[model samples]
Target: MGWKWGFFTAAMVALSVATWAAGYPWLSERITPPHESTSLAIEAVGAARSAGAGTWAPALLREAESNLRLSLAERRRQEVRVILLRNYADARALLSLTQSQADEATRTARLQRGLAEVEASSSLSSASLAVASAERMSRAIPLDADGRRHLARARSALIEARYHRDNGDPRRAEELSEEALQQAQDAVTRANTLAARYVDEEQIRTWRRWIVETVAASKKTGGAAIVVNKDKHLVTLYLAGRAVRSYRADMGRNKLNDKSRAGDLATPEGRYKIISKKGPNSSRYHRALQLDYPNAADLRRFESARRSGELKNNARPGGLIEIHGEGGRGIDWTDGCVALSNKDMDDLYPRIQLGTPVTIVGGDGSGGVFSRAIQDAVEENRIK
Candidate 1:
């Protein structure tokens, strides 16, 4: 009976020892310190904040930070720590993904803003250049009603575009600037076309031939001839077919066109003779040389226009065209007359006599002087 009882006690002690050994690892794991993954996750959260994740991934970062704090507070249990470590690893991976997406989004936005700025600047420059070109051409040529209207529209568009640009609307500004540039370009084209119509190539060639013939005839006769070039703003005195002198001159305010009636602010183009002269005492200018305007050809054209109803029945072809002094004002201010400086007049008045032939031509007698004049005006008016 004693031996049987000892065997049972030994068997019970062995079973108890085996059961204790099996549970020892489980208890040790529960009480152990948290894994390294928890620390790594905390560091990753800090890094994300430093990289601006707070602004770009606020919700994701907030949740991850909250979970990490909860896990750290309960870190005494080994099982709990292990679970927290796993959760932290997942949070870190999510944080990394969030930061990458945020970075990509920020880069894309910056690139778009930069490209918009470049386009806006380029469009503004193009619009400015076009407006400048249109202004210059308008100055050199006589813009008809349609041409004037187009230029006004272009200027209006440019002003509006500038307004948008200054108000911090880059997208609207870019679109408006492009529109302004196109309008300005169209204005220039219309103005140039209008100018071309007044002095076609054939007309220019005819004027050139006439100038040559008139100069040759004057030389043979030992008489002088006067040539007025409106585009060059010059009055040239030709003696015996030789250009003896050239003087800077100004014409009527609207000298781009030929005078067709009284009060027309334009200098007429024609052949004429100096009919008389007036000194400072008798003329408003320092001196004046009257020309025989409305000659036979002028009268015939006037009559024809009247018959065609192109001219008002009462509109008379005005006659007091003259070359006079009081110029050098840098602008055309005459009313159907050519003007020179007082000094230039003093030099020319003594040499020219009554009956001297005078010829007035438009442009350079080549139909190309207006183009050069437009270019010069454009350069002069560009923003300094």
Candidate 2:
């Protein structure tokens, strides 16, 4: 009986040992949280967020977070179960999947952010160049209110784009840069269209014909002639059919068209003659050479326009046009005259007398101001 009892006790001891050995590993693992997998998943999620996953890979980041939540829930569920019955296989799998999702999110975010940075930088450069080109065009061509507004808006957008790029919002920067580029291009287009007539070939040819006639008259009379080129911003002095001297000149505030009526701020076009000269004490500017603006041709055009109802009922063909002083301001600001510097006027005033031919024309049919502006616009559009 003693031997039998001992054998049964030994057998019970052996079974107890086997049970402890089988349950101890699971008990140790489940007694607390799934430290290894939980830590790995958390670290991976943190890495993904640091890589800008929230902005560039939001869907993948959300998925990673969701899987991590599920993993923690599964771990908690298994922790509450009896030690021998607990199985953390599902929790481990979820944690592993969460880590993978986080890693993928990190990779995707890095790639996308890199691409966006490159694109944003390229767009910003393009926008800056477009705005610069438009500004140059604006200086050469007079833009209406709407066209000027477009250029202003483009400058504002470019500034905002730079701000966003500095703030780490590359996507937003890219969008604003694209908007700036378009607005600047629009401004350029408007400038080109507005200056088209001034650069027309036929109109230039007519102006050239007038120049030839003026030069012929100078040669015949053995005297000097004057040619004012609005596009070139030059007043050229021709002595006996040959150019002798030239001076930088400014034109009327609205110099794009021929003078039509009183209060129309346009320099007169066509053949004219020096009617009178005013000294410094008498003229508003330093010196002045008055021109006969309402010649027969001007009267005819004014009459025709009035007959066609193109002008107001009371429109008058304005006179008192002149080549005067107080220029070199580097901008067109005259009422309806060609302006030269005081020194240039002093040098020119004595060279010509009354009835000397003074022809004012748009351009000399070369690559003038308007031509350069149109070419720039076309090239910029082609690049776009």
Candidate 3:
């Protein structure tokens, strides 16, 4: 009986060993490496956050992260532990999807922001250039009704664009800036077209040539000349065919056109000579350099205009146009005279001789005979 019992016990122990060996892999997979799926889910959540998922998919990310943490915690506890493999897998998959969506959204947002900034910058630059061009054109020539209207529109648009830009609406600002640029360009074009009616190409060419010749003559004669550009509101001094100095000047109240007669309030446009100079006590202004108005050319034009009924029969060609001091007022307030500051007059007084040439012309300095002449002479010297 003892032998039989020993054999039976041994058989039972052998069967138990075989059963444990067969189920070891299955038990180990279930019990060891706790929260493996949860860890994978956590890694996925981190990837999503790193990919900017927070910006585009905040709620989804929060839900996935919360579920993963809860699952991991429940897995650590023994009493209320639940099978979380499937749950963790689902959370990980969801997080991956969120990450992809967030990445795409983030990329799109960055691209859009970059494009907006570039467009806004370009539009602002273009608008600024257009406004400057329009302003220069307006100052040089009288703008017609349509030109004025367009210029006003452009200015309004530019102001609005600036407001929008300050308010953080870059897209709207860009649109408005583009509109402003277009309107400003249109105004410039219209103004130039109207100016063409009053100033022919031949006149421009003649002015340019005269300037060059005058500079050459001055250089040869070792003399000085004065040039007043009404539109530029500037006076330039040329000595020996080279520009020596420039000064701000104020013109007549109605200085846009050539003076026709006394009390016309228009500055004359022609060549003349400074015939006399007077000190502060001897003149009404601080100082004065009297010019010879109604020179030979002026008389010829005055007579012709009278015969053609362009000027009144009794109109007398104005005289006594001078460059004087005590100016510095922003606007043109003189009566057909070029006025300068006291300081500028003091500087000019000693440099000017009695016979210094003075030439007054309309429009910006670009087409002025004086500027062109100086430029040409300078260029020639450079070439030499």
Candidate 4:
């Protein structure tokens, strides 16, 4: 279609042979020189037509049609040549369009192939993430045994998700992926809690269990005392007004609003005892400390909400919130939990006993400015 010239010579030869076969033998024998010239011209015209150059064929058919007209001996040949040339032009145009369509089809095929590859690659990347998450959890044991079992089950589900995808079951694959994402989110969240953390690398932790046993063995006068200063953001040990150790910490994502009801933005204020401690996190956060967030006050508040339709009737009770260490130190950031450095949590863990008193200043009744904000918000809600 694109100006190929090879069809000309073949066209000429074919026409000459047809003329000889049609009884036009020699120029000198039966016809006048002019008549012979005209017959020879007819032969040339046939060849030109066969060559498929027609003026009407866009650029492609234009020349062949013009050439065929020149070979015509009679004026009527103009009409015949025009008709033949138009047909030739139409045929060539069709051929050109067919080629274009073929090329486009090839391109579309390649595009589909590329998208299929992306889908495959995304799947592989997702699998690698699952393996890494599992491996990360395996390196550390959760502070609580029950937490450990849940984490194990989550990892197992992730494996099944991957398996179903590889085996070509998309329905199962989608469901498993959804569950894995949820579990991973929850596991990382819970890991931040101090109620369930582990000893940091090469850090010496408190031998609280040993201390408590020794104290219990000796039958000491007072129970263990835990204190937190919301104003100073300091957690203190009260062995009689003596500061044992202080660690830098981050507050919460929300301001002084103590988390009163479930999903409250405020961190709860007031006196509360540590019920459990969770550990060295397997999460991106360096370490975590779990606090008993939904204490008796929280439950009562939540219960009222449930009855009044202020809370979701089917919501699962979230009881454990925490103080923990994140990827880096400095800056308060959490849903409603305290935060510390990974190294700090490791140092503080052993010193904290199971029933230590935790007094958050901005959190408890004697809280810093933060606690007042929580109190104000709570009061405003009550007024409304």
Candidate 5:
């Protein structure tokens, strides 16, 4: 009986050992953490975030993050369970879902970044064209402080956008490019509105009339006349109704408008004559030929403007208008005068005697410099 019992116990022990060997493989799988899948999911989430997934694929990113959190929590729960009962199946499933969502989010973000790069490049090109247009317009009709400021801002934005585009931030580049385009377009619009006056039919007709009458007078008297075209920046000498010589001229600080009153800083537009000539020694500039401003026509206009409330009651029609030297500064700087280089003034001073007609007009009837500049700009815009 004792020998039979010993053999039975030994057999039972051997059977227990066989069972543990077979089940160990299955139990080890369940008890071990899903470390590989969890790590892969964590890496995917990091990649998505780096790809701007939050902005471009918020929904997918959120799901990925949430699933990753749930997976980690499940892993922790499994870790706390009895070792024999521990199962990582739920954690592994959640990790798979997290990886899927994170990878999708990354793909979506990468696609958006590619599209944004293309859009940013196109927008930057458009902004460059607009800035060129504004530059042309500004040359024709010099912009005021506000217009210049807008143009400067546009250029600055364009530069910044290019920097971002070259550095792999296409989304930010696209936004800046859009801003540049708008600002440059605004500058163009303002310039166009201001330049409209250069093409007014009535104004052009008046300028043509003045030029014709001055030439006619010179022809009849066989005397010299001066014609100043503000838009052309030209001072033309006419001898007996024929143009003999021309020189470049600059005008007032605000040269666009006719002189209205004191401190207006605009060149006067009308027929006048040299009332006085100051030589190099006495003149503030190298030489000066004074004109009789506030002539009958000028007075009439001034009085009318005052009546219309365009000028103050005490305002005086400023005088001392002249054709002066010390010019060629390449800008409008005078109070209200036509300026020439010292050499041009010296050549003209001797020939122009007192009472020589000086006809100043806003433009020369024919499309002047401003018009040609605008036309070129339009052609360029069309081509681009």
Candidate 6:
């Protein structure tokens, strides 16, 4: 039980993700990150057809989630299957053990000759039952090491309990048999915990897979590619990020020194990956691209200062954030987050795929389109 929760979670996740089987031959169940440099997206199209999931045709993943959710609800209700498995296992174990005891009482079994057969059969039946239960739920929730210990002890007690009764110690034998039953009763709770955990794992796994497939389909739909209009000091969207819709945007008064620390008003310059997305509900901007802007370079720069105790606690508050719609009337001011017109947001609300990459730059800075720090990480080796 030391890590029972974690193990249960992982098993459940793997089980739930198994739910999304590609029906057609060509659609791939897997997709690699675009940074892999070799596009696996193209390969996935081939897999989709072979698997019978159909061609790389676009379908709304949000709708898929609805369908998947209904299926999953049905999957969870199969808890009855767990009880059926347990009953089957109990029946098999009891039948075998009872038969062995009857034989031994009649002198058909000896210490060395008969006990091993009973033990092996009992173990096999129990294991089979556990697997049956696992199959019905999501993942197998076999007894943990502690549970196994109890089960082993219970089996041993059954053997000894019967031995005592045959040897004229009926009360002692009854006590031992009762002890075995108690251990099993305790294990019932543990088994149920594991069963429930698989349920959660299934949910999380389902969501992540849905996100990947949805993003992939969106890519195929082909919006404007990302673009920047420097002279106008505005970033434009193409089919990808391009201005299938565009909005009037204002750049920092001075784009050279970006806002690194949370309070710094300067905008950041780098290749940012959107890690999280939230809807119109805003604590900050109106919907946002929460960028993973801080990199190792930024960390290393402040490390010495941190050791010397000169820098503020825990590096700069690192996200370079952005969202559509200016907070109020036209403003050329921002700490680092970008501002887009309300009209632009209405257009962007549906199209902005999560995990989209946004690159920042100096109005007239040198180096690559991506920030120097990010470019170095990508070229030096391959940074995640």
Q: Which candidate number maximizes lDDT?
A: 2
Off by over 4 Å in 6: 1-231, 240-245, 251-255, 300-317, 327-330, 364-384
Q: What TM-score should be assigned to candidate 1? A: 0.72
Better of 3 and 5 by lDDT: 5
* Better candidate by TM-score, 4 or 6: 4
Task: Tell me how far the alpha carbon of residue 8 in candidate 1 is from the true structure, in angstroms, after superposition.
Answer: 18
Provide the overall lDDT of each model, using Cα atoms, as 2-decimal numbers. 0.74, 0.90, 0.72, 0.48, 0.88, 0.44
Q: Candidate 3 — worst ten consecutive residues by lDDT sum?
A: 375-384
Better of 2 and 3 by TM-score: 2
Per-candidate count of clashing residue pairs (backbone under 3 Å): 2, 0, 3, 41, 0, 37
**For candidate 4, which ten residues in a row score worst on lDDT?**
195-204
Runs in model 5 deviating more than 4 A are 1-32, 82-87, 114-142, 145-180, 365-384
What order do you get sorting by TM-score, best first? 2, 5, 1, 3, 4, 6
- Candidate 6's residue-wise lDDT over 1-384, tens digit each? 859999999989877766544422222211211122112222333333333222111232222323334333333343245533312222223333333333332332233223433544444344334333322221123455665665566666667766765664444565666665555444433444433322244533543344334334436666423333221345545553224544666544333344456566545555455567666785355666566657555556556566777667765645656654553334446666666666665666566567665555443232321233223323432222
Better candidate by TM-score, 2 or 6: 2
Candidate 4 local lDDT, 126-227, one digit each (tens): 544543453344232132454455456566767786787677544465566656655543443343242121222121123233333333432353444555
So what's the TM-score on candidate 6? 0.32
Go through the candidates in order and give the C-alpha RMSD of each one to the true structure.
Answer: 8.2, 2.8, 9.6, 19.3, 4.5, 37.9
Give model 1 RMSD, 1 decimal: 8.2
Per-model TM values vs. the true structure = 0.72, 0.89, 0.48, 0.34, 0.80, 0.32
- Cα lDDT of candidate 1 equals 0.74
lDDT per residue as tens, model 2, 1-384: 999999999999999999999977766665556688899999999999999999999999999999999999999998888866777888988999999999999999999999999999999999999999999988888888988998999999999999999999999999999999999988887887787777688888898899889889888888999999998889999998899999999999886778899888989888999999999998999999999989999999999999999998899999899899999788889988999999999999999899888999988768767777777678767223
lDDT of 5 by residue, 1-384 (tens): 999999999999999999989998887889999989999999999999999999888999999999999999999999998988899989999999999999999999888877888899999998888887777677767788887987999999999999999998887898998888888877766665566667677988988999999999999999999999988888999999999999898898876778888788989999999999999888999999999997999999999999999889999998999999998787888998999999999989998999999999989657666666556555655222
lDDT of 3 by residue, 1-384 (tens): 999999999999999998889976665555454444555566666766664446545655566666655555544543244543312233344444544444444555455656776788789878977776677666655567898998899999999988988776678999999999888877866765554423455665655565666667778888998878776678889899998999999888764567888898888887889999999889898999999997999899999999999989889998889999988675788998999999999999999999888888664436442233223323433111
